[model samples]
Target: MDRLFRSRRSTVYSTKGIVSSTQPLANAAGTKILEKGGNAVDACIAVAAALAVTEPASTGIGGDCFALYYSAKEKKVFGLNGTGRSASKMSIDWLKKNHPQHIMPNLRFKSESVFKVTVPGAVAGWCDALGKWGSGKVTLADCLQPSIELSENGFPLSQCSADIWQGEVERLLQMNEKDENLKLFLPSEDWSAPKTGDVIINKPFAETLKKIAKGGKDGFYSGEIARSIVKELNKRGHPMTTQDFSNHTSTFVEPICYSFLDHKLWEIPPNGSGIVALLTLGLIDSLNRNGTIELKSMKHNSVEYLHLIIECLKISFRDSDQAVSDYEYFKKKFEADFHSDAEQLLSSKKYFDSRSSLFHPDHAITNKEMKEGVPNDMFKSDTVYFTATDSEGNACSFINSVYHGFGSCIIVPEHGFALHNRGGNFNLNPKSNNCLEGNKRPYHTIIPGMITTESTTNPAADEEELYATYGIMGGYNQPQAHVQVYLNMILFGMDPQEALDASRISLFAHPEHKKLSDRGEGSDGPSSNDITCVGVEDDLDPDVVEGH
Candidate 1:
């Protein structure tokens, strides 16, 4: 597959700096910052803000963000969790009493539900990142200026963003009638989605960005923006308060790592679902070490290889779903009950071996047979992921998102941005680790990935050097893509572009037929025979598909 696969773009190289993203305009914004002598973090924040304006359907300031930064000077990695907590006054008991109709297994709140909106955390994350890792040559206002200009002066909608926006037209139109801010997105005379090449001017959103630039974090969290958020949520019968907005804070955490191919893969632990990628890699590594499978000997995307990868991913997801949640909750539960923390437990080779022992080379494991591994208990989200590397050797892997397209579809007219429905992921069962609770973050999906290797010159000193900053943006596709892209480069020796462009497989529950037993209409409840499907790209070998 490596020899047969080709990339549309060549591997990009730069001695000064490089920034990569989905939108050209956003990329330009980051490069502009880099040209202005800003470091990778500064460029990343610029790119993130520009994406909010250029790719509104996928990301915005009214969302959440996470970042992993590799410091060239310190020779280490740092993680920031910028996800918001649920409203302090809301909980499972309150939700059940007020909205009993929504109670169900694996329930996701409707996109338009006010109760689904959590405090927006992206602004704080951006501000905090700049304060901690910025080059000090640029200010918050400087990083955001490009986005403000694009919003106020207008920019042509890119073809990809236009297509995504058009697909969400129905969802946007179905928003609450009082959400007049929807007009900012429906700029057409007929109130339809804007087409490609259309110049979209968002003066209101520009003004909001200006405020944030001028006042830093407080500009969004405690000023008129916060008041507006609270008022809009309150009018919709949500229990959100201004204090909830003010209390939002991003957490700094040490990254968790797994060794593979003589390098370390770093991920922002648990709550971000990066553990799934680590566990999947660990399982494969364990299998290879124990002579259960020989990955290099098998053809990429062959029936045997695809089946093995899919099975490992399924096992990882099952364990994550049972265990991943708010980091605070995870620490409390694991420390008091299990006498260990998430990073220590999830990264253990013993646990990985215990889970990998379940894999059978010839037999596919059914959902019923895959249970959470005893050593642990664990954690979709739409998002934008981009990476930047500076001349100084620092790298930043950043991801930002507003969950589903158009987020909650509950636009704030004055702010010209939509609230995110991250609260929708909260479990209703109080016994679950991810159960809905006040002032607690729900399971998060956005994660930034970093790679590092031991310093060659100072191996005895334990010094490290940055290898790469990378991520793939999609809900559940993230971890799966991370694993595939990493292996494409390490095992197959593909360049960066080929690694990303290579055909991949994803394992997920079938949306329409969630359970095999309840395949008919009105079958929305969980059942014993849930079906997990393997999705592959069209370019995959036909024989491999048939064999699988």
Candidate 2:
């Protein structure tokens, strides 16, 4: 019966330990670290860094990141939010000087040329994590060693990449006609498909690796690498400044925890979308005040659950639109009140005042699939999600991105790092959430996950201790992914892999993926994916949950 719900058939093993990500190369590299006796953190660093290099279309040093980690020894969770701020130079007034209306890349959304650029913070994030949590425990240098080498020596290209390059060659080369780095990664030529076991290499990337090996992550953040970035973006008339490079930093916040079933789900705070997932799961729990999740209940709950979640997301995003910004600005507009009480805020009736049964049980469900749908699209283009767990019960769940891939499509020359156009998500109409601002961090696509158990009694008693992180990659579906994964795994009692493999959803208030039935708000696009995409054909209500 589970066969109908399976997502992937491939799983590879590594001696280093264990790492699971969308990209096989990164997964292998992370496993290598574990095999080498590195812990979950060490393995995470190795794979995540390698993904930045080998999977540039998905993520790079210039992107943003969010994470949730569980320390078995401490029995607590730590949240690391790595969204970056705009360069001190990046302001609405400054950008509009050269263009009409001064809207950043309003025209370039289709071109993705040199004009679409923003400050990057992922490199600083990796460095910060390694420096503080890594230190002597796990040599920061060691975790990134493989990535450095891969960048310099270059790894072979997968068939999926070759195909994407073939499709997007013009798009890839539009920014830098003479740029060898872009050309090499997304070669314009098709060298035929891999024959079972083929090895491809990247030499320029190899040189890039060598530079990092000697300079450390800082080499990319503020030194020679930073210089290269500034030079390249400047050459293209981009407005980023050196201050942007130096100003990049990640934040450590307490994970917003929500109770569901017997476990608590945790996710990092804004500029990430993890809050949406936490709230959605909470609403589901609030609804199931008395009953265990049965398949019939699960199916009926899918639509109602989605209605509430989208409503919560609408509310949360409203806050994020206004309050969440780059850390500095958010600090002013959005107070760091760990007591924001996500579950309380979401369950409040004042918000999410919508009817249940947004979908019908009698109707045939749509066959909209999950995943980035691009496969490589998972990390190769816009976003990626990776999770790591060790026998010691130490776990880390991380989601990072360059935002729609290759980030803003502007490469900072010497830095060999591409800038992200995360700012593009903003609205300039003045009447919208997420308007552009100086020193404000763009809202992010990441939502890191964490798993933990609480004692059965009020005071204290024995309870199961489980630690893990699970994430799904998709733009609007991210937090929804977090919620669906938790439902199938915790509420339904499925394994992590199996839970994610089960049927899932792509909940949204917007109409991008959904097929809208009414002539109401967000009535554009194919509404079938949204309208017909809920509930299964012949499954029990609680037996199967969908979307992840």
Tell me the whole-model lDDT of each prediction, alpha carbons only: 0.81, 0.57
Deviation in Å, model 1, residue 442 alpha carbon? 1.0
lDDT of 1 by residue, 378-476 (tens): 321467898899999999999999988878888886788888887776766576666678888877778789888999888887778887789998777
Question: RMSD of each candidate?
Answer: 3.8, 7.6
Over the full model, what C-alpha lDDT does candidate 1 score relative to the true structure? 0.81
Colliding residue pairs in candidate 1: 320-379, 322-378, 323-377, 323-378, 324-378, 324-379
Q: Which stretches of candidate 2 lie over 4 Å from their true place?
A: 1-17, 101-116, 188-199, 290-296, 299-328, 332-381, 414-417, 429-433, 455-464, 507-548
lDDT of 2 by residue, 361-381 (tens): 233323232111111111113
Per-candidate clashes, comma-separated: 6, 49
